[model samples]
Target: MQAAEADLEADPRVAEVVAAARAADVRLVRFEYCDVSGVAHAKAIHVDQLAHKMVEGVGLTRAQMALNLLEQVVPIEGMEPVGEIRLVPDPTTFTVLPWSPGSASVLCDQLDHDRTDWGACPRSFLRRVVDRAAAMGITVQATFENEYYLGTEIDGRFEPVDAPTHAPVYSAIGHDHLDGLMLETVDALTAQGIVVEQCINEYGPGQREISVRHTDALGAADQQLKFRDTVRGVASRHGILASFAAKPYPDEIGSGAHIHFSLWGRAGEGGRSLLYDPAVPGGLSPLGRHFIAGVAEHLPALTALTVPSYNSFRRLVPSAWASSTTAWGYDNREAALRIASPFYRREEASYNIEYKVSDPSANPYLSLGALISCGLDGIQRGLEPGEPSRRDPARLSPEERERGKVRDLPSSMAEALDLLEADAVLVDALGPLLSRCYLAVRRSEHAAFAAADVDFEIRHHYYRF
Candidate 1:
């Protein structure tokens, strides 16, 4: 066994995990990982074998990373079925499945036979980015504000629960309609240690948005995975289908998993907000402006990671509140980035930027990691974000947009992928192997959708995310 694998066996946490499982009567422990397609896959072991498996991890074929949403394995070199990798669990993420009886789960990091981080592991990629930020004496805190739909399947056709009468956006009546499911979901999430901050009925007929408090960059991604699992699991028990698809119904408003982020100084440097400066106009520090500038500069390529699926484009249009241009503004929903208003008397603690273009179809780890990479590059170059738009860039005339340096985001998955391939900063952040495999998988999906129809696109993406 490798030294790191051996060390896992000797760690006291293994025994504690085993004893806790026994006490809780957990019959199986699932070692889970979110794939490049944002789909969660797992291999469960009998409780009796938990300790041994925790150390050695469950073996998986390397080709897993090359698999697209359609389950086709793209032909990426070195990511074939001939090699193997391990799913090494992070014990801190171990949580009993509140929605699934007699089962527990632990998030994992993919490692090679020698126990080194595999380049294609999304979790490991985020770790590398977090380490990079730490080297610069900065820390990132973030959360994914996910909006999803609640529906039921009838005769293989999915229909929203509020199909007959659309609930008004943010209406109390909508909350009453899904009260039981929403409350149980919140309880389940709390049971798993995730702090729920808000729940509301969204603009779509049967859409809902449940948000959680922010955490350290890595934990934020892990929490997002847990949050998705819990919401879906609980909804299933009620015989309801929950979807985080960007556009679940062609005629309805789309759902988004907006990202809220802030940077901070290291604990040694008083751990104050690096993005806050009360004396400055808009309460945004110079560092915050640079970070936003970096994201704007790379917004075209960044969309390939954030709004990844072909279905995502269905929602990212002008005046849709999903953002269509590379513009930042104070509370402007039509801009890709929004500088949120800080709370009264708590500006420093509450200051953060919201990336509006992201969706639930994205692998949280990859999107967050790529975001930090772009922001860091901005800091390194001292880039300025220019003027914040008070009106929608899409509403401005072509001449006005050019004068303001505003650019439109890619309108389709294929276009976004092309931008990503040509971007040196993002490609370098993903590293060679990961960039190659990710592009291969996404390209395969885009090709498949290109050959198919709109119904085919909606069918595949609806429940998968």
Candidate 2:
């Protein structure tokens, strides 16, 4: 009946079904949604019922709200009132289940019982930050480079399958495990207009990396969450378990969820990238410099979300790509805020700022939001990051780093939680409700992790997915 409704209904997920539904003689459509922790879920609808669902949104038990915490589908008794939560179709997120017989899925946005946005929705959290950027005549563009791992069953134990299949450390030699799946996932995402940019095999055994094209911050975060779900779902149908854990092997190289950010204006005007500056020292725009300062200033507190697992700290070692310190670098991969290219002075060519602290387990919505919040705060306060560490801060004799004020993120989820607790500013940025929910979930996770016998899955999951 309306333009937006029509556009959503005609989304690729619904449109692709014409052939599959007709060929299979099916009369049902499925709509899917992701809870706070990024877990995916789906519900089916009769073909005739699609219009109402798309126009008005579908309803799920309110218990689903706790899925991010409780890790189960059903509502927990005494947890909260289990009424109905709405799943409104995100037309931009339609994709066919490549491994499924003929099923297609469209992502959804959450709605409360009163037909309003759920305060705790992760996507909405990201949107709030995006809106803030808009007010300042600034637009942040983001692209996610996800380094995930593939696992295997070893003698009744889950382990990183040895190369050929497991891919021994950084072996540039032939290993096809990551190749096929990488392209398949990318192609599926781009087909649905998700804008996948590049795919590569990582150094860790069974590790792979893929990144989306840089775009609006909100859209990038939304697409990243959707992309993770899409990849996991497809891998699942193929009988492969896609774990988004930061590290799956204790002794192996860990995985990272690198975030590359740029700046622009609303409606995509002015279109200048914020990372470069010909006037300021180090070729950084004042806004860019301030943003970097904000990130370095609040990195510890931000970790409660970016790498929020007990198993996560095991991966954030100094030597690993999972950065341990809060430092910036000009063209150094070892630093958290890597200037991907420092030699290039061109506005378009000089785009780089890597959040090396993130891992696959992170909620991209929260991670990116936290990042923008920190940066925007810096810009508002005109804070300068001081200086970019010329050498690898992680390796700089502790003495050298201290002089530079370089600091490590956190040694464990336990430490990260503590830092998050002390960060009133970040807590304010991420609402109290969400901050509490997140802290509760993370604390519980830390307890369970520390209590468990440090096993292969917990250690390897960091990279495996």
Candidate 3:
């Protein structure tokens, strides 16, 4: 039976999607979203119910947003299951599941029963931040270069699918070793509307990085969710697992979801890169300088969102290639923020900034929202960051660091939460409810990790991704 388009009562795009799903004989649909813990969750329904589900939305427990990475509902004071929220499907995010048979998926925005945005919803908070940037005549474009490990479980131990001695950063032999999985991953991501610019074997054994083309801010975060799903699902199809844990093994390079961003004026006549100017020193426009300074200023508190998990801190050590110091630099990987200049083109379109402190376990929406809000704060206040560092902050002498005003980021999750609480602007941007709940949940994770072994935690996270 054909599902009537108008009967769906959602946006016309949603109606068209439902009609298409019916025509394609899709048996089930997955309403999917990322929870507060950065874990992707879904509620599946038969295709026959798509029409009603689109308008009414599938019911999800309010406690879903209060859970930790282990699916345990964190004992946050205001986030108990005294209520429910609706997962309203976003038609713009609908896509057919390439790996899962006879099933399609769409992302959703969490809402109260009255259809108003939920304060604790990460996706909604991201949208609010995006709108704030819009009101200021600014646009944020971003992309995530995600790195993950491919491994298989054997007799309760996780082992890499392919191992090579020493670091093979972009080794052709390493890429060829997993070329089948990489090609399949590319195809799967392409099918889901995520543009894969390139994929390669990274420095660590069994580690790989995929760089997707950048888009608008919100779409960038949405694509990250899809990218995670695509990589994990495609790997499983090839009889292996893809783990995005910040540190799946001790003594190995951890995976990161490094964010690259560029600021632009709003559409139409305002369209232009605000980060580039030929007249400025280092080609960084004044507005861009302030934005970078803002990010550098608030980076300590922002780490609570970007590197939320306890495992994330393991990846941010002195020589892990993930920056731990609050400094910006020109193409310096050891700095928290790096100014990326395009080698191929000297144009504004190629100018951008890269934030290297974040890991794959972070909620993309929250991470990106915090970043945009801080950059906007910089632009408004005319904050000026000092000269960019030429050397890795970790490798600098104490006198050199003091001279540069460079400081180490929070060393632990507890310390990061402290910084987040102390930062007024970041707290306001996240709103009280979200800030409170996030702190409570993250603290619990931290405490849990302190009470357990690192290997135990690694095992707990490795297969879940």
CA lDDT, every model vs. true structure: 0.91, 0.69, 0.86
Q: Which digits, one per residue and each the tens of the lDDT, describe model 2 over residues 1-465?
A: 865457446665544444444555446556775554544567977655554466577877666656543353333442365567788866555555554545666667677767666666677778789889889988888888887766555665555433545554445542455556666777777755777666666776666767778777877876776677777766665556666777676776777788888876555576666667767665677778888888888898888778866666778777665678888877767777876665444546546687888877777788898889988888899887745778767668767786656887778778888888888778888776667667766676566656667773364343233
Question: Estimated TM-score per prediction?
Answer: 0.97, 0.86, 0.96
lDDT of 2: 0.69
Residues 169-189 of candidate 3: C-alpha lDDT, one tens digit per residue:
887677778788789889989
Sort by lDDT, best first: what order?
1, 3, 2
Winning model by lDDT: 1
Error at 70, model 2, angstroms: 6.4
Candidate 3 RMSD to the correct structure: 1.9
For each candidate, C-alpha RMSD in Å? 2.0, 4.1, 1.9
lDDT of 1 by residue, 1-465 (tens): 955446546987987788788888999999999988888889999997888788889999999988999999888998989889999998889999999999999999999989998789999999999999999999999999999998988887789988889889988788898798899999999999999999999988789999999999999999999999998999999998899889989899999999999999998879999998989988889999989999999999999999999899999899999999998989888888898998988888999999999999899999999999999999999999868888987788777676656898999999999999999999999999999988989989999999999888888998898
Off by over 4 Å in 2: 1-30, 68-79, 161-172, 175-179, 267-269, 342-346, 397-399, 456-465
- Please report the candidate that would top TM-score against the real structure: 1
